[model samples]
Target: MLSEKMIEQLNEQIKYELFSGHYYISMAAYCASKDLEGFANFFIIQEQEERFHAMKFFHYINEQGGDVKIIGLDQPKTDFKSLEEVFDLAWRHEQFVTKRIHKLMDFAIEERDHATQSFLKWYIDEQVEEESTMLSLLRKIQLVGGKGHGILMLDGELAKRQFTPPAA
Candidate 1:
């Protein structure tokens, strides 16, 4: 059974994940408005991934005999002046998520919840990949600049992105 403190923290994390999904969807809308179809597609996939992440936590909490609480999500920004800005925000958000995951891991360790700790190990590793991927995209965006041809090339590259849901 999860302690009340752990359940509270996990609920907060779930809200954050839900917010991430909303944020990505907002980004997708912004991309679509800007006529960057590929970029929009990327964020649409990201939104789905974020939803999956939240569901994983939801199911895990229930599996551990903890209460699963639904929380309201904050609105995400839907406007971006440039692709660089969009990608920069994404990279920063991933870094933020990494820190959040680390905090959860620390909490689990402090409570000596071995099962929670073991479960969180996957998230810790996943956050690393998440941050790395966003950072890589940011670097590529920096290289491309905000010019038309550059943006087109980046869009083409983004079009190749495919979402593969994480294994159960």
Candidate 2:
């Protein structure tokens, strides 16, 4: 069973996860406007993954006998000066999310909630991969000079990215 505080925090995380999806879709739109179809495809896949993450929390909350509350999202940034800037922002965003997940894990440890800790372990692992992906992509963009042939090559690579839900 989850404490009321834990439930509330988890609900807040759900909102964050959903907002991540929204934010990525906004990024996708920006990429599309720039005629970066591959980049757009990448963000679209990212959006789908975020939604999947939100649903995981939604189901977990219910399984733990907590009421799941849907929260409103603020507008995501829709404008970007360059693809490198977008990836830089995305990498920073992932860092922020990693911190949030760590804080939640600390709370779980404090409460001696073994089940919650175990559940959060998956997220802790996921955050590592998330941050790494963003950083790697950002570095690639930087190395590629953020435009022309290099950017096109990266776009083609990202276009092949598909959202594959992790096995339950």
Candidate 3:
């Protein structure tokens, strides 16, 4: 069973995850509006991942015999001035989520909640990959300066991205 404090923290993280879904979907719409189909596809996949992340928390909380508290999320931005701005926001958001996951891991360790710690290990590794991917993409965007044929080439590459559901 999870402690009340642990449950509270986990619920907060769930809210954050849900908010990430909202944020990414809105970004996806913005990309679509700009006719950046590949970028739109990328953000849409990100949106789905965030939903999966939130559901993971929901299932875990219930499995732990905790009452899942559904929290409200703030509105997400729907407009972007440029592709660079969209990607910059993504980079910043991923960094923020990485910090939140690290904080949760620290709390789980302090509480000696081995089950929670073990569960969070998946998320820890996920966050590492998430940040790495975002940083690598940001670097590529920087190299291209969000202009000319380079952006189109990158878009073509991102267009092929499809979300493979996690293994059962």
lDDT winner among the candidates? 2
> Candidate 1, which segments miss by more than 4 Å at Cα?
none
Q: Which digits, one per residue and each the tens of the lDDT, describe model 3 over residues 38-119?
A: 9889989988888899899999999999999898899998768888888788889989998999899999999999999999
Q: Count the backbone clashes (under 3 Å) in each candidate.
A: 0, 0, 0
By summed lDDT, the worst window of 10 consecutive residues in model 3 runs over 159-168
Candidate 3 off by > 4 Å: none
**TM-scores of the candidates in the order shown:** 0.95, 0.98, 0.95
lDDT of 1 at 52: 89
lDDT of 1 by residue, 1-168 (tens): 899999999999999999998998988989899888999999999988899889999999999999999998897987688778888898899889989999999999999999989988988888888888878877887886666687888888888888898875
Which of the two candidates, 2 or 3, achieves a greater lDDT against the reference? 2
Residue 95, model 3: Cα distance from true site in angstroms = 1.1
**CA lDDT, every prediction?**
0.89, 0.91, 0.89
lDDT of 3: 0.89
lDDT at 90, model 3: 85
